[model samples]
Target: MAPIQFQVGEKYFTANTKTLTEGSAWFKSLFSGSDKLVLKEDGTIFIDRDGDLFAIVLRYLRSQKVPVFYNKIYGHNHLLYDQLLTEARFYQISYLVYYLENRFYAGYVASVKVEILGLDHGVDVPLPDRDDDTDVQYYPQWCRKEVYVCPRRVAVHRGNPGGCGRECRAAQGDRPLEYEDEWVLKTTEIRTQTILKHNMDSVKP
Candidate 1:
């Protein structure tokens, strides 16, 4: 058939049925069974999306590789990144989700650190070394003790990306990600207090 026209914002991009169906199941359903698509007199479908960002998505669709613009976007444009994510989900493109998550994780890990509670001390899980270490976040002396990390097991069980919440498994020791640290300690402390309170009541009587 003819090239399917998409009007993103004030601009337009063209795609064919084959390319749309190959990348997105949502598109597959939309094109195959929907009469709701508003087609121009020239038979082009008008899609309401940000043309600039949708252009990036289309590039990824055409070429399996993410555009080099991703490098410029990393660590700089959280807003655009989030917008792109919204667009990706709207289109039901799994590859876009995977690419964004993985790419974002690189910047995320550099700026965030995960800490595990130890019996006598806190074990700091260092992030991957980067050439430019300026943006890597370090814990303040006071906040160091307050920062507790979620283990991979718990995050994965909760459907966090990479089976570890925040893609933090690289820092954990060889243990299941669910192994609780600070939160578990707090719960245990509360439970112990309750038991102690009961014992004290019995003794007082």
Candidate 2:
């Protein structure tokens, strides 16, 4: 296979499509003779990633393992770590992504210093855990349809004979982070608390 030139993160990189296709479903589908993706003037692809992360990806493709260079970098930089995770997921390199996320989440848990108040009652100090399936059956949804369309508007009666239920849409939600689903994947088995994560680096000192 010819090397496909790509401009990721506005940097140019030449990569073998065959190696990429083997690792990523996204790559296989994109380059599988489908004309949906447009090529560059130089007959290459233009992906929206910066050339930086792809460099690590290329190294992984060559070695078939997470790059050694990634360890210390994620240890010191949270922002870049998140960025690398996004790139890894986009490329569908589950092995690389799994390790990166485990590293990041481990760092996050070790550094978690926030004080959480007991929100056993339905108050906002710590927010209630809305994930319980019972909440959807007992409460009225606090919704303003004019703002946006939410799927919670519909209700289904599940696991009860002659029982009816309505959806509950509370404004304050405690859903997992964007990468949390990846973390919760049974194959990845990323052990973590259900609380949302935050980075101190994001706050101005």
Candidate 3:
């Protein structure tokens, strides 16, 4: 896959940087079952004392096994904040864009309280492929709430403009915006320098 090259203006950090192995290992154990990696008062990171910001980006660019799952009750802001580096590392995106997309998709990102470091951090991206619903079954239970159902026959809204007009009329004629090209992946490179600066500062202090 040549590691999916991102657009030039798109943000990306090198992944071959160094890490404080002992610190990272200790950090991982300290926050078991959670992905919140942070720095201690003395500036030692939980994951790596000398972790490379670029390398973390590469980890995400290479794998999808990591997902920042948080307690829905306690809220997921801290979880998301902590994993900003991780997400930027693996997904080849800026932390800002990553958080913004997740926020819009989840529909409640505004309430979460954490600072997304850059000025242009969370701009909205327009919904893409607004007219497709062929993958409705792939959606979560919350997404099925307003779906239109047809009882007389077995017709599902395929979201194609002319794909199922007659079939829907014969079975279930009603329609709702059932689905679109859900943006599970996107690029975010603008905040790379800022993050890199954070890494440098951590090392100095």
Model 3 off-target regions past 4 Å? 1-58, 82-96, 99-205
Query: Which 10-residue window in model 3 sums to the lowest lDDT?
Result: 192-201
Q: What's the C-alpha lDDT at position 46 in model 3?
A: 35
lDDT of 3: 0.34
Best by TM-score: 1
Which residue pairs in candidate 2 collide? 8-49, 8-50, 9-49, 9-50
Highest lDDT: which candidate? 1
Residue 117 in model 1: lDDT: 30
The residue-by-residue lDDT of candidate 2 on 18-43, one tens digit each, is 88887766778888876657677877
Report RMSD (Å) for each prediction in the order shown.
24.3, 22.4, 21.0
Q: Which stretches of candidate 2 lie over 4 Å from their true place?
A: 68-75, 104-205
- The superposed Cα distance between candidate 2 and the true structure at residue 3, in angstroms, equals 2.4
Model 1: ten consecutive residues of lowest lDDT: 187-196
The global Cα lDDT (0 to 1) of model 2 is 0.52
Clash count of each predicted structure: 2, 4, 12
